[model samples]
Target: MREDVGEVTTSLHRPTTDSSRSKPVRYESFEWPQQQQQPPSNGVPRSAWNRQHRRLSRWHRPYTAVLVFLDLISTLAASEIADVFLEKSKSGFQHKSWLFLQGSALFTFFAYVVLPLGWLLLLWTNGTYDRRYLGLGSEEFKRIVRTSVTVVAAVSLLAFATKTDLSRGTVATVSLCALLFILLCRVTARQVLHLARRRTGHGAHRMVLVGTLPEALEVYTAVTRSPAAGLIPVAIHITDGYAAARGIETPVPVYAGRDVLSLVREVGADTIAVCGSASAEPGELRRLAWQLEGTGVDLVVAPQLTDIAGPRVHIRPIEGLPLLHVEEPTLSGPGWLVKNLLDRVVAGLGLALISPILAVIALGIRLSDPGPVFFRQTRVGHDGRTFRVWKFRTMYVDAEERKATLEELNESDGMLFKMKHDPRIFAFGQKLRATSLDELPQLINVLKGEMSLVGPRPLPADDGDYLGDVRRRLLVRPGITGLWQVSGRSDLSWDEAVRLDLYYVDNWSLTYDLSILWRTIWVVLKRKGAY
Candidate 1:
């Protein structure tokens, strides 16, 4: 069980895991145009919308059913495997197997029936099939983990109380294996639904955002981009306090404050999402919920805190007043130690595994340019300390001296000076930059403990435009690849780049880091946003 928890840390994937680029499709200042621009009639009848909601809401029953089947299969498979596995251990160390075999040398009938039934009951009663966890698989997956842990704890206590001999190794193996199968079932199901949505726009909950322009647009971008979340915005209802005097045009239908309910009926929007500004008022939302009672429309409230994930936020109700608590991010903990250790191991393995390529790159760089093979520049590190970040030189030795002459050609955002076709690099150097081989040598800094395998990109120490509140990102070691690497590399805007960096620091986890690493593989290969 310890090894199971350690292998795939739940903290690896935070509850608010969103990997998409979340920037909104903003327009000129919204003028709150008079006419309610209805959704273009796709001829998708209103009955189709109701069927979609039914599928989304009740998907959990089938989801849980699949879980039960997978658990049964996992139990049978683990029994066979564990019996064989623990047999060797038994012969070697006088251990017991997991099957609870009777005198006939076969499993007891109760093992097959009682245990599987218990699993289903525990899972169901523990809220694994809750409506809120249906489409988006994060919560559903988490509940499975919670159920497995709690059951294991209960079994351990029962064994101790009854003075029954329980094979710790066998129990751990079956629990972990069963969990693996259950999650696999959920992942496969969610992907099927995601494919349905992508191909046909089926099984998604249509939404209408009601709030001020800027904040509403933020929510709009999030829901629209994250189709897997099963929330899609079909219309907008701008409220007061928006910059309505200025002209603005939304990509979708726009509605007035009074026409939100009518717009929902017009488009069959199942979710009435109330975002920031006047629409988020308690009295107003209560009234909205009251109106939505029998209409089958769900009311969702998105808080002003953007980009923060679920684990950090807690709702505490005291005297009927609910208060939100946000846990501050800390860099010092056992988790940090695990991350630090993982950084060195992976970086070392990475360098060793790619030694021949590193050598070949070294040879190519030396032959291409009659200068240093390595580029070392001062970069801001954790807590604002400066370190010489290493990289395979992908430019001429006089790259810095040529900066002034190329200042007029800068195409990058903020204070970042970049040019897609910069003349400063040697001929072969451009390929390295394009393929991201130029940053490979930063693995050395990672091994040297000056950087991490995944964290914010280490920028030049003198880059001042984004040095304000973003300096908090310096609280952890910089990385060779990060949200920036998989996000858009150098193609991201100044604000987007900083936002990704800050988000990484705030949502640091082994799972998040591994995801970035995995995405980096394809992002680097395709060179999508590389310049």
Candidate 2:
């Protein structure tokens, strides 16, 4: 065996869990890699962890604030467009710009003023406004939508009773347009920002891979395949001879059979992504993590089950020890009502607002090729109910018939079938999906009350067989936009999608609804997850 000690340092170290706690995990003298030694036997300094936390948050805080600001603007603009058109238009023919302005101001006042107050109530009632919920998922968007609707309804009633002379055409036009336009702007901004971060390197966090060579390679392949994620893998450190002999050469340097703690220090790595199932002693894992605790580095364990998402895996503390809890997904009761109400409101609004866009898409589809303007498919919805989900036709007439033969090229996870670069899509269809204009027809499903503004995903009935604990998802109506669509859409593993839906089910609130609606803008505009 050849020993290439690039930078070797050794030290005897003690692992401490806390300065004030009772017994800590005691370890004898350990041979750390020849990179760096622990400071004189007392303990490893703890300030390092704090530094990493600050660094990570510093990068994220401004970006999040930008999102919030953009969301506010969307709400304002939508209302203004509606209001301005109404104000300037005559009795029969409403002025579009005046309606837009009126809608923008109304939506703006409603969102920033009325909705914030409701959020305060929600905070007092259900703690929905806690900072922890921000950027978590669709919950925040759900609340925003619901609160805005409430304000709109209240204003509608007041104007009617007070004889305020607000034109129905104008009110409807402005209200709908404001919401749509505002959402569009926010989505556009998010995609731009995410891409900017990926390119600038300011948005991503770096991690070192730790495992057997094979397992490390698996993780490397996965991370590298999606550079848009902003993860920069700086180096690889193998813990065994088996990994070292694998002949895998990475762009970054590799060190073999090095002590984990030493590698963390000298490499200046702030995090470690543990891969594969190697039975390392529990004591050793704890020691390595404890030694690096104050350094701001983190340990992320990649379990063998690659299909599952974070929300599905729950950790519980049992008798002073931690336990992982996996819950069955289900939607029930008030969750259904909240979802239903949102569906009705959003569907009504979408149909009205997108009428022009729908016409445009329909004309384009018709002109591109000879076929019906709309495409209908039998997709399963709430309680296994079958419904015809609609989209502006994006494929040839025989697409469904051709689907069976092309199953071999399916590149999706779980029961969901997808082809990243499917040839079946018509020339114009690709652009439609990328911009999400194709799904506009599903607004009819919303109006028919077969779907919602937001809920668990809708799947093809035959595809239902692939589900495990998936029926819980159907307790509420399906949506044109749902947890899966907003989070990562086609890019997610089936398990990851299920986890998001279940999270929505377990914690269904108006706030969650608002968050999802808001996120839909970015999901559609970024078009990263669209096929």
Candidate 3:
């Protein structure tokens, strides 16, 4: 029997003496030999090994079943909706019999049986149900989109080859509706899984950390802070020598890295994350890979590269050696032109649509406070240029005068000043800040080319001129709402906000902008991290 120590179980190799059995074995007392030994090939029995494989399958099987069910329902419902809409239209679909199936009866057979099954088959072949990507990342969604396109292309080709007259409207509507439904279902499923991981620690990977004390600690801090990543560090192996473990403050038990395979087996860690320069040792990582071959364990390498998105990074293999090629940040070119055009167009339409709300806000501010309806502040913009950022006033006229007294209460670690409840904000101003309604006036700035719909938030000119890589954020126009705004707003530390802003500047894309805009809506609705 094994003893439980917090979330991690104690080593399984404790002595079975009477005294030892009665007393719990502490994690710090566990030790391994300095010399590395080859892992035993047949340490676990064949039946037990098979059971290990079955355990993983058991975890993902239910989720996969749920996905399959959802996909079937979505496809069938889409087909039925298309059939009904087309049947009711003036240009009614001409139904033809195929495979001994006329009229609405033939359409019903295809809708109820053929379309759903074919969609499932295509999705399966496209790896949409792969366990590795089922509830994580955007790979699953990409596969679903690719499969949808394939379905449309395949149907068109088949109809042309057979010289059969299939209604163009039916094919287009069913395909589009099915794609939307599947994508929605996937997004919902991912959110539910993330919630479970955050609240209950369910579906988390039990991982062992391997590297020097500092590197391992960095990885540990990152994973623990992000519960949605689902990495639970159970043990640490100091690769710089066990002496490096001295004076370290780690939440998990620390052990010598001389024999990683033994440590993993003792703790039952399903994943091993080699951090920082630990993999640089010649043949060390290769040897670890050989050891993990049939143990049903996953090996992950955490490269030092941080905050870079997937589109910017690519693997280029030359003569069997894989090298990472990071593309330069897109600061100019056709993409920037498109982004600029989009910003102006969106801002123009938004201002037109919400002009009434803007007027009401202006009136409320005018009545609530004795000041200008709009506040203008000089802020650093693209290429170090300064511009007046406009916003519905959310503070009293004397707010600036009171700032000197509130300086000591500022909680931010960096240049920005932040307070959860500022005394200068009136009752109505607080509501405006919470719902971000005060920011609606920035559409005018975007339309005037002084800002963007999505980019780094402009900082006050008093924040000082940015130097080094931080200046990269000024390559693009400042925005009304950005990554920093959606992520945490005033709640984030100064360094974190800068890091998020820099990341946005380096990895800007149209799709990325769209995703940020979508998340911004939710952030505003939830009023998360708002002052």
Candidate 4:
């Protein structure tokens, strides 16, 4: 209720899911100061749910205040550092010197008070400090950029409107430095929060999932899979007779829907997340909201929407009744042209930047084997068009010919072939493969317009594994590294690989591409699931 983003509690004591029982119930004593049921059994001195929620509620404001303080300090430090640097530049900054001499007090006020306060105001106006945009996602970073630009625009407007004389170089330096510092500080803060969440699910809300068996397990799996910036499912409240369904296998309890209030009290739930299946009619849901008025728990109603990106979603309120609107995915036209342009430019520069490394790798390949330095294979690209994809040769010359002999040793599913210790690979090739240096040659294909820097990975042209309705993958050009590459590579199941590829195809955007490219660096460094 205080702020929206996150909150949670911790305790080793948790509920157990009983498969055979009608409802998995915990017998923690439930009592009110004055109760009428069963002679008022005494409650646990302090339930985990209550303790966790209380901590979440109490610390929400203080935590947000700390974030705001960090922003202000970062802004001031950047301005001061920029001031010191600009004082040394001597690039027509005589105006600053004149200001110091003629308006020393004004200069002090401008540097120490006005600019910093103005920055804070601009950030607040731009929603940089809003709880809804504070943690995770590029929205926060974008807001910071917007705030900085808005401040610059305002300054330029003032200069034009009032003939205000200012040092151009100093103003530019301060603006650039402030923007950089804000981004750096925000990124660092998110890293710290991520580490905290991963280490211990702190700053995440404790959730009571209210849904039927199938629907409840969906939410449960989603929350558990990504614990960072995720809801911690404390308990599952199933509809009247569906509690006995064996969908869930967690220590989190399953309760009858009628026992929602008691379960919430017992588990110290901070939020009640009502999934579409369990969120009765509008009238019933409204009444339920009334029933939950002062419980100190946030009520969230989730519509049954899946796999839709935030940009395509709009919530329209017609006469105070919320209606969901979903825009179809953008698959072509101007955006696609931009994605292609970025891919080519970045790939061109990438190939040039890494030419030295490529040469070294080529030398190693020549010394290791007498075959060609590049391995060219036909792979399907945009619109099912086939193009030759290049990679540093990591296999022996006759490896393809010997494929039949090792067919029995295949360890991978789908059309793809993978073996941890395949005889086809050269000794030096293993290191190259493990380090992902073998894929560097694909940048040439990327530069050639046959591939993109980010998209679904291209499979072998003759490999018809994903050619059904999943041809949706070929709607865009293939990529050497993509959702599949970053999401565990060869370790991903066939279904999982297809899912990731399709998700990329369906929700492609410039921002999304950049995010994946950023993630790709970490994934490559770790060599997770690579072989």
Best-performing candidate as measured by TM-score? 3
lDDT at position 344, candidate 4: 86
RMSD of each: 12.0, 12.0, 6.0, 7.8
Model 1 misplaced regions, further than 4 Å: 1-76, 83-113, 134-140, 154-168, 184-203, 225-227, 241-246, 257-259, 341-357, 367-370, 396-409, 419-435, 462-466, 509-511, 518-522, 525-527
Q: Measured by TM-score, how close is model 2 to the native structure?
A: 0.54
Candidate 1 lDDT score at position 301: 86
Q: Each model's TM-score? A: 0.75, 0.54, 0.87, 0.83
Q: Write the per-residue lDDT of candidate 2 for residues 161-242, one digit (tens) a residue.
A: 8666555675566456645653465456545655765677555556677766577777776666455555566677666643
lDDT of 4: 0.72
Question: Number of clashing residue pairs in every model?
Answer: 4, 58, 0, 4
Tally clashes: model 2: 58
Better of 3 and 4 by lDDT: 3
- Higher-scoring candidate on TM-score, 3 or 4: 3
Model 4: per-residue Cα lDDT over 396-444, one tens digit each: 9999999989988888877788898898999889889989999988988
Query: Where does candidate 3 stray beyond 4 Å?
Result: 1-58, 90-106
Clashing pairs in 3: none
lDDT of 3 by residue, 1-531 (tens): 112222221221211222221222223212222332344443433464343232321346767888899999899889878867665653443454231222457657777787789999999999999978876667898899999999999888887998877777778888999999999988897788788888986667778888777888888877786687777899887665556556656688886523556556567566889988876753667666756654567788876767787789999999966678999888889989998999999999999999999999989998999889999999999999999999989899988999999999998888778899889998889999999998999999999999999999898998788988778889889998899988888888888888889999888888789889988999999999887
Q: After superposition, how far is residue 70 of candidate 4 from its true place, in Å?
A: 2.5
For 262-371, candidate 1 gives per-residue lDDT tens digits of 55655556677888764445555655665554444677888888888787899999997677799987577888999999989988999999999999999999999989
* Candidate 2 segments exceeding 4 Å error: 1-37, 40-196, 211-230, 236-256, 265-268, 273-282, 293-320, 323-330, 356-371, 395-434, 455-477, 482-516, 526-531
Poorest stretch of ten by lDDT in candidate 2 = 22-31
In model 1, how large is the Cα lDDT of residue 31? 16
